[model samples]
Target: MVFELRPASSADLCFARELTRETMLRYYIQHDLRWQDEAFDVAWAGRENWLICQGDSVLGFLSLSRDAKALYIRELHVIKTDRCKGAGSWAIEQVFSMAREERRSSLRLTVFKNNPAQVLYQRMGLSVVGEEDCFLRMERMCSAAP
Candidate 1:
C-alpha cells in the first residue's frame, strides 16, 4: 500500500494517542518508565510532530526537534501490524529528505538498545555515537556524496 504523510491535526488526537501507546508497547514494553502519556502530550502540543496516514488510518508518526545544525528524531512509532513493511523506513527517509533539504549537517536519534529497529537504523547509515542507560544514541552525517 502507498503511504502518504500529512500534518497531524487536533482531530487525530484520539487515534494518535492509541497508536502511539500501542506502538510503544509493542517495542518498548520492557522499558522502565511509562512514556505513552508523556509522548501523547508532546505529540499533541509540539509543532514538529507528524502523522503518517495511509488511507483513513494513521500508519505511524514521528516527532522531531531541529536546530541550525542538526535534526533529531525525538520519537518514531509505527503500528505493530505495520512492522517490516517499509513504513518506518519511509518515515525515516522522509525525515532525511527534509533534513537534507534544510541543509542540516546531521541527524540524530535515540533508540532502545534492545529494539530490533537498531538494525534498520544502521542499515539506513546511522552509526552509534554514544549510549546512555538503555538508549543507543545514533547520528547520521549528511554530506553531499561526490
Candidate 2:
C-alpha cells in the first residue's frame, strides 16, 4: 500500500492524542514505564506533526523536528490493526528524506528499550547511541550518496 503524509492540524488533535495513547500504552505497561496523558500535548504543538494516511484512511502519525545537529523523531505511532504492514517503515523513510532535505547530518529518536520497534529502527540503519533507564537513543547518519 502507498503511504502518504499530510500536515496535521488542530482539527486532528484528538485523533492524534488517542492514537498515541493507545499505541504506546502496551509498551509502557510491559516496560513498567510511567505515562501521562498530557505528554502528547508537546508533540501536538512544537513539532511538525504529520498524519500518515493510506488514501482516505488515517493509519498513524509522526512528529519530527530539526536542529543544527540532527532531525529528531519525537513520536511515531500506528494503529494496532495496521502494525507490521510497512506503515512505520514508510514513515521513517519520510523522516530520512526530511533530514536529507534539511541538510541534517543524522536522524535521531528514542524508543523504549524493550519495545520491539527497536528492531525495526536498527533494520532501518539507526544504531543505539545511548541508553537511559527506560529508553534507547538511536541515530542514523545520512549518507553522502544522495
Model 2: per-residue lDDT, tens digit, 23-97?
788888888877776777865788889999999999999988888979999989999999899999999999998
Model 1 lDDT at residue 142: 82
Give the TM-score of each candidate: 0.84, 0.92
- What tens digits encode model 1's per-residue C-alpha lDDT throughout 13-33? 677677767656645558676
Q: RMSD per prediction, one decimal?
A: 2.5, 1.6
Candidate 1 clash pair list: none
Q: All models: lDDT?
A: 0.80, 0.89
Off by over 4 Å in 1: 26-29, 36-39, 144-146
Model 2, 81: alpha-carbon shift in Å?
0.9
lDDT of model 1, residue 1: 71
Output the lDDT of residue 58, model 1.
77
